[model samples]
Target: MINKIVQNMAEAMAGVKDGMTVLLGGFGLVGQPNNLVDALIETGVKDLTVVANNAGGGTTGLTALMEHGRVRKLVCSFPRSNNTIFEELYRAGKIELEIVPQGTMAERIRAAGAGVGAFFTPTGVGTKMAEGKEVREFNGRKMVMEYALPGDIALVEAWEADRWGNLTFKLSGRNFNPVMATAAKTTIVQTQHIVELGALDPQHIMCPGLYVDRVIHIPYGDPPF
Candidate 1:
């Protein structure tokens, strides 16, 4: 098997290009892949469609990405947050947005990873969110058809990763990271700890090596080969 570890964040992010859709794994600021985000900023690719749970919480990370004019559109549940960066860019029409219900958003990413083509839900029924979308009734209740949200690349944060790419997440830090690891063509993870292949307990593992493509060490550590 080919080694999945890269020497630096730059190498980890070398595949990201302009006009690509990326799944950024996190909920609010928690679990956001800071090292990868920094690498993307340095890479300076633009016209991106970023999918995430929320816009970056503060004036850095995702906010800094917007300030640098990298993202063209955003698919997320909460666009408004601690920083006004997205707001200002959005108001000036500098960015595009699609607001989804939080639960629906999670399922959409999960559905993509699970190979589910489409599904119906009641989240956006009767609201503007359902505009121009197919709707139907099931068991006397209304549901809107939503498509899966697969991405060209997914950047996830994991608390620990085995040398072979199996990952385990920390408490709440697991937010969105597991599913995002499977929904993208390539998944690059920024992990806090890199353990030997058998170091992780099978029961504690949250994502298998089959889904993860690259393992990167945090604080910009050298590649773990």
Candidate 2:
């Protein structure tokens, strides 16, 4: 097996550049890849398009990117109550925003990874969310078709991973990481623990090694939250 480990978050994020679309894996504040987020902030890459369920509560998750004024667009399902930076940017027209329903967001990413161009869902039928979108009838119900969202890079958090890159997430953090892995051109993983090859059970691996391009193990003493 090829070893996918990297020395640090900076090395893992080496290829990220300006004006790139990045998919961030996490639900709320639960399983965000903090180390990678810090490194990206430090890299100072600009004009980023971030896709996530929500921006971190404050200056925590993707909010860090917003603080740097690096984010040009956000394709997210919802904005957290404390995400003042995002709200301000949106209000000021400093950033472009595309709001999607929570369930539709997940399906969009999954469809992208599966190489599907578009799929229909009934989640937003008859609502403002359905405006300008392609609509189709399925089993007597109206459904809107949404296109897949593929990103240039995907930043994800994993609870544990092997040297070969088999990854697993803890609890709620597993929300979007797995799907985002396959939808991005490059997938960078920040993990709480790293183990030798064969350390993790095959059945427990939520994301296989082939989908992962790099892995960084956060230091044991480092604060995750």
Candidate 3:
């Protein structure tokens, strides 16, 4: 009876603390764990460093955390979205922002999960993004060194999950969830459907149970935005 299922968001977020780096799985608004995000905000944990694809849209989800001044820093590929919270905070010297190139950011998270020390890529060479970083020649092409990015906790959403924690995602919703799952110390899932132990097809499982620590069921619908 190795059930990873948790009763509610509070239990799933129990071990999270202040001043931690959290990985949020989503590409814009899709694939985000809205309930978990809301729970984290409710916990009132301040000084968090959140890593995500974008700031957020509107005044909910990740933006709610920013609006409350809970996030001290944001490490994301894009800060601009339908919402202007991130931009306002950055300009007012209220929040820190680190803009990683999209592909480079994904690879960095993957490298962390794969136990890689560091990697070199030509993604941001000869730009301000490459400043103060190691650069070397690989096949006469310059590559900038990027380090692995790991998180204290990761919150991801899934289309379906089982008691064993195997997860499947819908199309574009699968974007950063899988990689973020493996790169965090604790991976918590907010799933739309919870099935029996053997319900998930082996081939369809995008994120296996070993990488997941907790799963909470939050049915898919019009989530609070």
Candidate 4:
């Protein structure tokens, strides 16, 4: 029997190591795997390069990770929030930042999962984001080439999961979880509910079991950091 469920947070995060590029799923705080993020912080791994939609806010999840100085760089669309963790680290020269356009960032992650070598888009054409990148013309419009974004590990949160690792998200929580699941070497999920193998409805499963490597049940509520 193939079971992807793990009994504890440590087992779920066993493969994470220092200096790895980690993809974090969430739009702000909605879809983040707070449990896994907290575990990663506890592991004390350093020099991580994180890819996410926005730099985290408040003193939990991604923001807490940044505050601990575990991350070396961040590849994200937006870095500013009500919290000053990212800004403090950035101004103090403790971290590196790569600003990618929101649409391009999503496409890059999707491209990695689809096995695409590269893609061209007009989102950042003629801007500093396009600097040093190969540009081509299609129908007289300039497009900048962006490569796929892959991660060593991806931490995601799902509303529900089964023993097989199939996942379902609630409303806006589905944001980047599905794509991040596919674009990482090891995708570890923190699900609120872990059901029996056949419990998940096939039509509603957003992320298939094939893409998930580990799942740990975390239930509902904010996990301590």
Candidate 5:
């Protein structure tokens, strides 16, 4: 098997460049790829577009990238609560924000993974979320077709992964990791534990080796809480 494992977070983020779209996998502060995010900050690559559930709490998760003024756009569900920098940048006209509903955001990333261009849903109908989006009627109700979101890189957090890059996530942290893995050109996983090949059960693998291009073993850190 090809070894997708890297020495550290810096190696995991090797090819990421300026103005790239990155999908960060985590929900709030839980199961975030903090080490990789910090490494990206150190790289000083700017003008990033990050897609995630939230930016994490203030100085944590993707917010670190925002602090360095690296992020130019955020494609997220709700930014009002967790992201201070995002709010400031939006008000200052320094970044573009695309507000996707929670469910739709998940579905759109999944659609990208499945190689589908667009799909229709009733989640945002009759609201500002529906503005400028193509809407069609279905069974006496209106639904909008949202396009898929494919990224240049996917930064994911996993509970454990093998040297071959098969991964498993913990609980709710699995929210967008699996979908984002397949939807990105290069997928990097930051894992709490890196085991030998064949250690993880095939049935339990959340993301298979083919979708994952790199893995970083992050030593345990206090959960951003």
Candidate 6:
């Protein structure tokens, strides 16, 4: 098995360039790849289009990337929160928005991972989400066309991972990390603990090593409240 461990976040995130689309895994900051996000901020790359569940708040994680003016567009389900980082940017016209239904967002990324180019859904039909999109009838129900959300790179967070990149997520923190893993060309994981090969129980592994490209171990504690 190939050992996918990288020395640090920088090494794991190498080759991230300007104007590239990146998928960041997390529901808020719960499962965010903080270390890797910090690396992106430090890289000073601009014109990034970020795809995530929500735009981050405060000055960390997804919000940090937006705060630094690195983000050119945001594709998310819930773009608002107490932080207002995303809102501030959007209001100023500094970034563009593609609001998608939460379930549709998940499905789109999952479809991309599953090698599906596009799919039809009734979730957004007759609503603004369906506007300008190709509409078709399925079982006599109107459905809207939505494309897959394949990304150039994926920043994922895992609770634990083996040397081979088999990952286990903790509780709700697992949220989009697994799906985002497959939807991106390069999947880089920030793991809380790195175990020896074969240490992770197969049943507990939410994501197999095949979907992961690199693993960076960062010992972190609970999410900031």
Q: In candidate 6, how many Å is residue 40 off?
A: 0.8
Pick the winner on TM-score between candidates 3 and 5.
Answer: 3
The per-prediction tally of clashing pairs is 0, 0, 0, 0, 0, 0
TM-score of each: 0.94, 0.94, 0.97, 0.96, 0.94, 0.97
Residues 1-225 of candidate 5: C-alpha lDDT, one tens digit per residue: 588989866787788899999998877777778778888888889999999887557576687778778888999997865547777878899888898999999888988888999999999899999999899999998999899999999988888998888999887778788889999999998898899898898998988988999998885754655
Q: Write the per-residue lDDT of candidate 1 for residues 1-225, one digit (tens) a residue.
A: 556777787779877889999999877667888778878889989999999888777666788888899999999998888878899999999999999998888899999999999999999899998999999999999999999999999999888898678999887779899999999999999898888878999998999888888888885433222
Clashes of 5: 0
Q: Please report the TM-score between candidate 4 and the true structure.
A: 0.96
Model 2 residue 57 CA deviation in Å = 1.7
Indicate the residue-level lDDT of 62 in model 1. Answer: 81
Return the clash pairs for model 5, or none: none
Q: Which stretches of candidate 3 lie over 4 Å from their true place?
A: 222-225
Candidates 2 and 6 compared by TM-score, better number: 6
Worst 10 residues of 6 by lDDT: 54-63
Please identify which of the two predictions, 3 or 6, would achieve the higher lDDT against the true structure. 3
Model 3: per-residue Cα lDDT over 1-225, one tens digit each: 899999977899998899999999988677888779899999989999999999887677898999999999999988898978888999999999999999999999999999997999999999999999999999999999999999999999999999889999988889999999999999999999999989888988999999999999999664435
Q: Model 1, residue 191: what's the lDDT?
A: 92
State the lDDT of candidate 2 residue by residue for 1-225, as single tens digits.
488999966789888899999999988667788668889988889999999988666466688788789999999988764658888888899999889998889889989999999999999999999999999999999899899999999999898998888899887779899999999999999898998788888888899988999999884443346
Any idea how many clashes model 4 has?
A: 0
Report residue 111 deviation for candidate 6 (angstroms): 0.7
